[model samples]
Structures are given as C-alpha cells and as structure tokens.
Target: MTGLGWVGQVLTVEITGFAHGGLGVARHDGRVVFVRGALPDERVTARVVDDRKAAFCHAELVEVLTPSVHRIDPVCPAAAAGAGCCDLSFVTGSHGRELKSRALADQLRRIGGVDWEGVVEPIGSSDTDAPQVGWRTRVRLAVDADGRLGYHRHGSDEVIAQTDCAQPVAGLTDGLAGLGGLRPGTELVVSIDDAVGDAAPARQIVQIAAPSRGRGRQRRRPRTGPPRVIEGGPTTLRRVGERMWQVPVTGFWQAHRDAALVYSDVVTGWASTGAEVAVGWDLYGGVGVLAGALRDAGVAQVWTAEGDATATAVAVNSFADDSGVHPVTGSTETVVTGLPRPGVVVADPPRSGAGRAVVAAICAAGPDTVIHVGCDPAALARDLRLFAEHGYRVRDIRGFDAFPLTHHVEAIAVLNRDR
Candidate 1:
C-alpha cells in the first residue's frame, strides 16, 4: 500500500470500511485519507482537509453519492454538526459499543500484549449504560460572537457555538440555551444536570465554565484558591459524585463521566464477596470515592489512604455523610505502611502507575489478593510482572473502556497471594 498516492482523483469508488472516530479510509491524493461522515460502501464527493507526511490525509465528506448497508442516519444533533463530539457520526448505538469492545481487545493485544488470561467483558454498572441516553449531564461551553454556547473548533482559537445538543442530559438543553443575562462581551461557565436533585437515583452533574477557559489553561486560580471566587471571574466546579460537586473550579476530580461506576464496580466485585471481614487498603485513594463504593457493597472495614490534604478533607466530608469508611491521610506509600495488613488491597495510581517503591510496598503489605487498577497499561503491566515475581500471580484480568473513543482503557487485575 506504499506510494499509492492519488491527491486529486475524485473517481466513483466503492470499498469496505471501518468506523473509527467518524473516519473511514479512502484513496485521496494517491494515499489514505480518513474521511468524516463517510460510511462503508458509500460513494462520496470528498475534499482533503489534512495531509500527513506519511501519506494519510484527513478528508471531509461533501456529498454521499452511495451509502453503505451498515450506514444509518445519526440522530444526535452534534453528529454532523461537525463541531461537537469527535466521532460516532454515523454509528448505531449497539454498533458503537461493539466498536468499543473491538477497539479495547485490539489495543490490549497490540499495546499490552496480554492474552486470553485477559477477560474482555462488559462491566455491569450505571455508567456502562450511559452512552445510550443523554448521560452527559454536564458540559463547559464557549460563547461565540453571536452569543451562542458551543464547543471550540478542533485546532483553531475560535468557538463555533450552538445553543442546543442532542446528547446532553435531560434538562441540560434548556439550561444551556437559557442562560439569560450575561454582559454582552462576557463568556460563561454554564452548570447543568441533576445537582438540584439530592434524591434522584438517576441524577447527573454537569458544568460548563464561562469566559470559556481554554483547554490546557489552568482552571483559573482563586486569588486565594477556590472556595473563594475571584473579584471578577467564573465558577469553579469540583465533582464529588455523579451529581454532587462543590463549585470553585481549582478542585480536582476524575475527568470522565463513565469512570466512577466502572472503577467502583470493578474494584468492588474483585474484593472477595460475601465475606464477613474483608479489610481493604485503598492506596492512592482519591477522597475515598472507590472505598466508599466498596463500603456500600459490604466490605467490613475500608482504610482509604491518600496524599492530598484538600481531597482528604472532601473525603472526610463525603464519608461523614455516610458510615463505615475511615480516611487515612498521608503520602500513598507512607499511609500504606502504617495500616494493618488486610485480606484485600486495591490501588488506583495516577498515570505513571504504581512506582517501584509503591509496587514493593504492595508486596510488603502482602494481602491475600492485590487488585491493581491503573490508567496506563504499560505501567500496569510492569507492576503486574513485579507482583508476579513477588508471588501475587494475576489470576483474573479485566479492562473497561472508560474513556470512550480514545486509546485509554482502565485495566484491573486481581492477584492471588500465595496461601
């Protein structure tokens, strides 16, 4: 397939294709161009939008001359608007999940090289089923010159704004489109979803910051840190639960919506069930969100340890509203050392995975089972091998496509210590 570049050819052609990020491959400029809004077996008038040195150009579908058998008209308002979500333009709901499964399997093989020992199964949770309905209860939007609230353009500094979206949570459509009084030139951070409902089981939490702060920009600092609004500024939202959050922006929380339930379900299920006394040591625990979930599921005693003072404060408040979870605040490693040995140990470290000392510490703690939930597969694999060397053999492994449409997958491994 090398050197087959057709830069200017627009000939009628039919070919099989795949749906990856709203893109399907076609010969453009004598090379492959991943086209938007194009389906398999569809003839289209396309134009090259991006060209890579590797002969892969990004194409835009101008017209569909012939559509594919699998082609289905997307109902999402943002699908073809070309400015909202990055992919899933022509995908059916079921097909979207399947594509997610396939992508996860392929990534494990190609990236982590972990085999059949790996269980690629659908995680049962409130979030796994989120993609179907308007599960996105929150969003941050930018205001265009026309006072429209939408997302920013892909690479440009401009915001191509819109008033409504199809995938927003139930009341978010009205919330976003109804931001009534704003200074003419002022930008806004709009909040939506179920924050108003404290008793709704299906509640959601959504936030859209105004003056639309640029991505990669620091969540605007409080002159004295959040809990304190700046003299003239935006609301800061720090999420504590699905629909519960304290707005003060600089607060840290997991970025994805589907992450909490998936992480909680995997960790809770892996903690040996129906046991009277299963003690869990949650290392690198962020505000004890995971530990609280396990506690709700019947773990006898959960000793959650974390490093952040502010997050620990939030954790304390979170558990104070509940019961059974004890928050231990300190460095993740130092906190692990002071805890009593337990039957189960779960660690969800940041992107670098568990460090060398942390891995050794997990081994030192010597639980009957070590459940490692990590964001990076390579780093996770490294620690998994370390645990194997120290007698924590990986018996069952599972992965969750927490970050949909991206290369990120959350893999949790259950290791059984030698009896």
Candidate 2:
C-alpha cells in the first residue's frame, strides 16, 4: 500500500524481532511495521494506527494468533488495559531482561560501532518465583477531566485512571483519595521514602503541577515555577548505602528502590581505579549522590553540577559537613567548562544523554577515567560513539534492569583515555 492507504489497514504478520520502546518488529508490503502488545516469534493481527513515515508504520495488536512461551499475564491491571506504567509487563522478568539486553547490544553495535555481549543483570532477589512488584518508590500521574488521578495511556495523552497500580510500593499512593479539589489536566507526583532502621520515619510527599498552557497547537508555555507540595514537606529523605540525602519531592531520583545503591556501587568500583586521585567531576549530578560515592572512593575533592537550583540547594546543605564536596548550580554544558581538571569524571546525564557538546567538553578535559551513565540505550550509544571519536576507549560496560517490567534499562560505561 502507498501513502495514507496503510492507515487503518489490518494485516496478519509474523513478529520476527523486538524493537526499542517495547515494540515488536514485523513487515508488510516491504515496509517495517512496529506492533505494540506483540512478542517475538508470535503471529498476530494488527491494525495500523499511524503511517506518517514512508519507510515504517505503527500498529496495535488486535489478536494474537500465536503467543510466545515467555508471554504471561501482566501483573498490573492498568498495564493490561494499555496503561503506560509497564509496557513490558506481559512478559516474564527473565524474558524482559533478555529483551533489554538484546536491545542494548543492538544499539551499541549499530549506533556506537562497538560490539556488546553483556546481559542486563537484575538488581534485587534472584528467585524466579518472586513477583516484580512494589519496586517503584516514585510515580507521576495525570489528572483526567473528572479530576481523577491516572497514568497516561501508552503513546497518548488520554489518562487511564487506576488506583491499584502494581509498580509503586505500598502506601505511596494512599494520599490520592484524600487529595481534594484537584484541577483537571494537572500532574501529581508522589514519592515515598521508606525508613531504614533509626534513620527516620517513612515519609510520603505529593506535589501537584499545573498543566502547561500552549499559545498555539504546537507551542507549549515554559514552566514558570516548581510544583507545589500538597501533602507532605518540601523534601523527602533517600538513603543510599549508609548515606542519606534530603531531596526535593519534585527533584530527580531513581524510581526503583535498589537503583541508586546499585548504580552507586558500580560508580564507586569503576571510579576507584587509581589511588590518591585529586579531583573528580560529577556532571548532571542530582543532590550529589554520585559525589558521595566519589568521596567513598577517596577522591580528595569533588565538584557536582546540576541545573535544578532546588536540588543544588539540597546538595549544598547535605554536603555541608564534608568540605571536600562542592555543589554548583548551572547547566552541565556550561558549568563543566569552569570546573578544575579532574582525575575522574562521573556523568549521569538526563535521558538526552549529554549530547555532543558535553561529551566534547569532557573529552577536552583529559580525565584519566570517565564513568558515563545513561537511562536510554539509543542516546547512550550515540554518546559512546562521540567518546570514541575523542580517543576515549571503553574499558568496561554494564547494564542494569533498573526499571523492571519496562523496556527502559540503565547502563554505565567506564572509559579510559588512550596513552
């Protein structure tokens, strides 16, 4: 079919492979069709939902003629109903990890020009019988027209109201019912910090943000202010290893319960390659988590730069007892230029993956060791390719199934400058 004729057409195709973003790859009429709710080696009838591109199209699974053995009932009821919380929840945890591993390897080879033969390791418990639930400590929901809290539908702005989402830890969403007079189309961010020993009591915070107003059909108004805390205090306590940080509720933190600890441990191991390293840089550091890890590795001085001023203030206050740690508030690309020369650099940039300029800047600094962390596979691959161009060779790389039951994977790459 040609032009818009493929839109709304139904075709039965064999899902031969998996694609990024939790899609199955199929071909019909010499064009690639990305089908949702299908798995590899499965035969399914799908309806094309979008055909904007000439080379590829998007389709929704209508019926499964054959299913893979790895397919299972989704633990989340909302996910079964097309909610966006858990796109890969229909598959077993092992299968999910395998798919993520393959996707990462594909991106690395195709985009980064590096071959990968690594697996995406699971974070918590290895028991096969254990259900992957109650791992998310943070969740964000959108308000529908009737002022009900729900997640956005997959690939759409429509809200799927659900109270029993299986991803969040218990008591995280308990305050949703108590919230009164919520505005429609607003966003609700709920975060819970479970108490550890005598450190502090369990705390949950709920913050609401007004919907962005658009001047036209395509232009959205920039956010003028931060989200307002409605239920709890402005900040929540997060404990990674023995260190605890007071992070703003609206600030960035790992959603999985064990993600911070796992990433921190990896960073510490890779960053402690040399003894008596003088200075280290933590770019896009949120609340100085990795900076503390650097300190644990015996780095004499550490500079952490973040754009969010609120998070930076928290980092400043949290690291006050340690004079060796410094928090700078500015964009990573700009602040990196003014930082001191470093023996090591740890960059945990946002999903965009520290584009070309930041990578070039880091390369120019000539750090002996650089640890790059990325949440998106494609962006990470592109950034890795950039590092290759700068003469930084990848020494080691690891992938973590941080976001279980989802297609998202966290990867860390340790690179060293060639002599």
Candidate 3:
C-alpha cells in the first residue's frame, strides 16, 4: 500500500460532516475527502476514486468500521446501493431535516449574501417520528439499451436496474411497473395524482424521447403500451383543491405529494388577501395554481405566464370559469416585459434563478409587493441581491423542507418596494 495509486487504495478516515450532495466529508493527510454512503462521526474505510493532489479527493465507501447513532437500515434497495435516489436514506427524518436546515442557512449566507439567522421551518415533513418513505410523487424512469425500466446511478450515464423504489408514493411505483414492456431506449416518467385524496388513484406514465444525436430537440408522448410512438394526448388529470389541471404525464410538477397545497398556503399568506390588488402577475406559473389562488383572494385581475405551451393550455382550462385570470404563453423574461405594471408580482423560477434582465424589468415595473419562490438557495440569494439593488428589501423569508432526506429545499421570500 506504500506507493499505490488513488483507484484502489484503502484508507481509514473519520467522517466529519455532510457536504451539499449528501456525501460524507472527511479529512485525509490534510486534504478533504468526500465519501458516498457514509455518515458523520463514523470511522469508515474508503477507496479513493479521484485523487486531486492536496485540494480534495472523491472516494467510495468500502466499509464502515464504526457507525453513527443516526445510521439505520435503508428502506429501498436503490437508496441502499446509492443509486441516485436518496443518498441520505440512513438519516432519520428529524436529523435529515436538521442537516437540510443547516445547508439552506449556509447557502443563504454564503451565496445570497443575506444575514439569515432563522431556522428552516419544516412544512410537509414536520413530524420527526414519521417514517421517511413514499414522499416522492414524481419519479423519472430511464430505459436502458435492453428495454428495462430503472434509473441512472448518481453522476453516471449507465443505468441501474431497480425492482423496487420506496421514495415514490404507493400507487406511483405500481404505475411504473405497467410500462416495463417499453421499447428499447425509451425514457419514461411516472407521477401520481395525490390530490385525489390519500388513495391517490391516478397513476400516469409518459414516454420522453431524448434529443437526437445531433439535434437538440426532444419529443414527449403518453405511453399506455410498449412500442413507443411520438404522438399522444394528455395522460391524466391532476386535481388541486377544487380545480382539475390537465398535464402531460411527464410534465413538470412538484415532486412532493403535498407540495401543491403547502406552497399555495405559503404564497397566499405572504401575498396577504386584505390588501387591494387590482392587477397581479404570476411569473413562471404552471397550470395557474397561484393565479387561481390570487383570484380566490379577490384580486380584480390576475395574469399568469408560463414557458411551457402544454401548461399554458391547461392553465387556460383551469381558469375558464374565472374571466379575471389571464394566461400568457411565453418565457417569463420575455412576456413579463410587455404586460402593464402590476400591483404584485410572483415568480417561481427554476434552479438557474431569474437572470438580471428579468429582475431589472420587474424593478422597472415597480410592483408594490414581489413574491419570490425558489428551489435553489444560491440562485435565490443572487436574485435577492439584485432585487435589493432596485429598491426592494426582503420583508420575510421562510423555508420549507419540501424534499426530505436530501439537500434540496423550497424557499419563499417576500420583498416589499420602498416607497
């Protein structure tokens, strides 16, 4: 072992803490080491995979000589094998929430440059004793060259065949089993309509085609049977409260089952129904859920913009009864520029966050109250700084542990323009 290379060298190290991607971090010879499938305060034997001289290194867990008290047996085979789903499966619900809170705090302070001392309020997974199983309402399934349905392991293109996944809701996994006969190289996504009460009766599967070798465009089609085709309609309907929304089976929706209600409550509370809002905009709105909430709160006119054409069509249907709600189809940065100045603005951008151009435009419009919903803390931080530069200050910030047992978090920030 004296002069061995990094690949197969076994080294004993004590895990100090967890990193962003849920990997256990350790120190070896004054260098940082990241080990998959490890826990804090445990002594583990790790095999170095990538040795970056003196700066940091990546390693795979070979064996745990001493385990932490929080460690437990993983519920799913995929998570136990570290197959990309839940790397923090060993952590209990309460401890997992604690770790996520710390991660979010660090991101807000380090990336967003905001002094946030508040705790990450747990919304969906508040019960510390509740079992962390079957929380994921949406699951993406990948088909290998052999036409088998499974998921690609973390950081690798090779697919890992999985028979059972404990992360998705009860009925959703059963829906994935129905599409086992998909044609070779077919990619699929499964989502459960949990809004149908606890039973979650609707289980829909959609086939998503990857971009062609040289082309950058991809196509999505609902898959009922095996031989894949490029043409199909909406797979199922998702009910949020009294409204039913039509979405492609593979369309983007919250991964958490209770996310729809939870997010809506947070946004509404921050929006404050008491204030008289004549006109408001819900940017990056999907299926107009927030817009519908605003209209219910007595907003005279609510306009929503979504980048997806399919989601815009469904938004039109959801708000057909309410003439006050207007649906705009285009990217948020493009469409928001044309609309008249609104009393309030709500944006729930993707992980990349809203760029400077969009933020500048919103500032120019000068909305009295701006509601920013974000999934990435770093992106939120950067955008919050931009908002502050344009005479808007963060009035309130609340975080929800939407995605449990992982590093991901959903945050809400309410910004008020200075008069």
Candidate 4:
C-alpha cells in the first residue's frame, strides 16, 4: 500500500453508510475509504485526497455515479462546493436526524462499548415549528486577508469567499450586509436573540470585533478585564425559558436558537421525575440559565460552577440575591469537591466532555442523579462508561436535532445511582 500513489487517484466505490464526522464510508481493495459529499447507498467516483497511513483513507467526491433518492440541490454553496460548512444539507432535516441517531448509536457501541439497543428519543417543543434553515443564534465569522467574511474551508485556514450564509438567524444574515464598513482582516463574533415566538422589539443584536493575534491557532484567551464591546454594550440579553440571560459576546451559549429552552426543559423534567432536590450542582453553568431552571423547579439551593470570569460575573449579576442561586468562579473538576454533596448534579461540559477527575468527583459526592449534556457523542460515550464504573447507570437518553441540517447533534443522558 505504501508503494501506491493514492493522491489524485480516482476510484469507484459504493457508499454503504456514514461515519461519525458526516463522511460516507466505502471500501476499496479491502481498505476503508471515507468520502465527503456522498450519501449512504450511493455509488460515486471519489478522488483520493489523503492516502497516508491512517485508520482509513480520505477521499473527496468527484462525481456521483448513482445518487441517492434523498439527495437534492444544496442551498449553500459552501456545502455544494465541499467547503465543509454543511455537507449533509442536501438531505432533509428529519432524515439527517435519523442518520445522526444511527451515528450516535455506532459511536456508543464502538467507542463507549455500550450497546444501547433502544430508541433515541427525538427532542423538540412547541416553539420550534418552522423549517431548520436560519436556526443559528450565534456565529463567528472569519476574516480573510482581502477583507472578506465567511467560514474557513474544510481542513484549512483559508477562509472561503461567500455571499450569504443560510444557517445563521435571519437577522444576522441581514446584519452581515451592513458590516462592510468594518476594517479588513478582523473577525466578528455576533449573537442574535431572535428565538421563535419573539417579537421584533424583543429581537436584539450584539457583536464584537475579536482581537486578532497573527492567526496561528485559535485559542481562547482568558478574559482578564472587561471585554471590549464594539457594537452593542458589554453584555447581550438572551431569552431562554421565560427568563432573560445576560451573556457576554465572547461567552459560551448554545448555538441553536431553541437549544436553551429545550435543554433546560429536558434537564428539569428529568430532575422533577425523581426525588425532590435539597441542593443541586450545575457544573460548567453559563450565565446561570440551567441553575435558574433548577431553582425554579423547587430546588432549595443551586450552586453553579463556571471558569470564565466574565460569564461567572454575568451569572452572579443575573442572580445575585436570589438566595437560592450561588455562582462560583472555578473549573468544575477543582471546584466541585468544595461544595457540599447534593441530591442532583447537572454537568454540561464542553465538547471534550467531563474528564475522569470530574466524573470521579461527582461520583465521590454520591449524588443520586446525574444529567450530562454533551455535544460530541464520542466524548459523551466515554464519560458514560466512566460514570457507570462509579455506580451510576444510564436510565434514559435523548438526542436533539438542535443543530439541524448539520452532523452535530446534542444529547442529554440521564443517569441514576444503581441501588
């Protein structure tokens, strides 16, 4: 195989299924090939992009010999041209969820070693009835050297030129056209509060020009002082679950417009089904959204731990004297042990998921219930296994099409201590 010059080589393969990262899997000469811009059960001619020794070779779709019936003309050029924004947008949102559910099951079985032979419940509420397009509430637009704004091409830092992105909130799409006055080569981070059922007056916009430092690798710099607000004040208001949350432009929040309410409802519903909570811990809580939800659900006290100073400050300001809400500024792994043990624990860690130390801390605390909200399936699966080792068993899990028209899916896995 090392002797074969695989780059630029064209091969006809029948796509059997999709892998976790939204790539179609096929076989060529007994070697697994991953092809982008192709769907399951479709035969296509793909050109080798990376033939280096890997778990599987990578290929790019050149021409579709047999297109799937579900394939349609992609609305976004980035996806159609294979710039890697939304390759699965060619299929309907419902079908995308089915594929995502299947991929999640595969990840759990292969990586987490858990054969969850059950249905992954689809999560949605009354607020989300419109189409999946223009669902993103927050977006970070990249700035190229030539003063163009768009997303980066797949696997490269070169920002692709684009006219308009159909994924962001409709207001954001309108706002981008007016941002031509900004300086060249400056990234802009923006958030829109145009959730479903909100009126035009309730809709708000907040944006900031990120400080660019020679674009090597994008790493989040710890906020030392107040964030330099360029557009709309220092903090922006995000309405979630009948309450408004003050979120800094740089702070973390759900990208999907309806994710906040859906997640809060799911978490609180799971908590309400079990024993009443004297106290609950919201690890990695951002702006106290879930903490507030837990408190509203009759929890006597909710202690939320967050690492970002700005976000924690916003959380504290948003619930300063609520008497039931306590916002602490620290990482969950280090701060979780400092708090008293509670009846319930809600952890929504980043894409990395909660590591072993945090899981150990939660397990050591002996909470009766644990709700893990994860964006990445592989990380969620690994953490689920760790939680199982610590005497907690998965009671129920639900997957949400929060990020519709995309491969990314959010899941909430509820675990209870096995007696």
> Residue 331 of candidate 2: its Cα lDDT?
92
* lDDT for each candidate structure: 0.59, 0.86, 0.77, 0.77
Q: What is the C-alpha RMSD of each candidate to the true structure, in Å?
A: 6.2, 2.5, 4.2, 3.3
Clashing pairs counted in every model: 19, 0, 1, 0
Worst 10 residues of 3 by lDDT: 211-220
Q: What is the TM-score of each predicted model, taking all chains together? A: 0.67, 0.94, 0.87, 0.90
- Model 4 C-alpha lDDT per residue in residues 1-419, reported as the tens digit of each score: 56356788999999999888888999988789999878898999999988876557889989999998777777666655545577677875556667788888898888777776544343443333232677777777666677666777777777776636667767665546455555455566766654437555233334344453444336544344443445655455687756777776667888877778888888878888555789999999978888987886678899999998888888888886688999999989888878988899999998888989999999999988899998999999999999989989888888887776678878889999989
Candidate 3 segments whose C-alpha is farther than 4 A from its true place = 1-10, 51-54, 121-126, 175-180, 195-200, 211-233
Candidate 4 runs further than 4 Å off: 1-4, 117-131, 194-230
**Which candidate's TM-score is highest?**
2
Q: Would you list the clashing residue pairs of candidate 4?
A: none
Better of 1 and 2 by TM-score: 2
Q: Rank the candidates by TM-score, best first.
A: 2, 4, 3, 1
Give candidate 1's error at residue 384 in angstroms: 5.7
Taking the tens digit of each residue's C-alpha lDDT, what string does model 3 give over 271-337? 7759798988999998898887676666789889999888899889878888999999998888988
lDDT of 1: 0.59
Query: Which model is ahead, 1 or 3, in terms of TM-score?
Result: 3
Candidate 2 lDDT tens digits, 19-86: 87888999988999999889999999999998888899999999999999888888888787778888
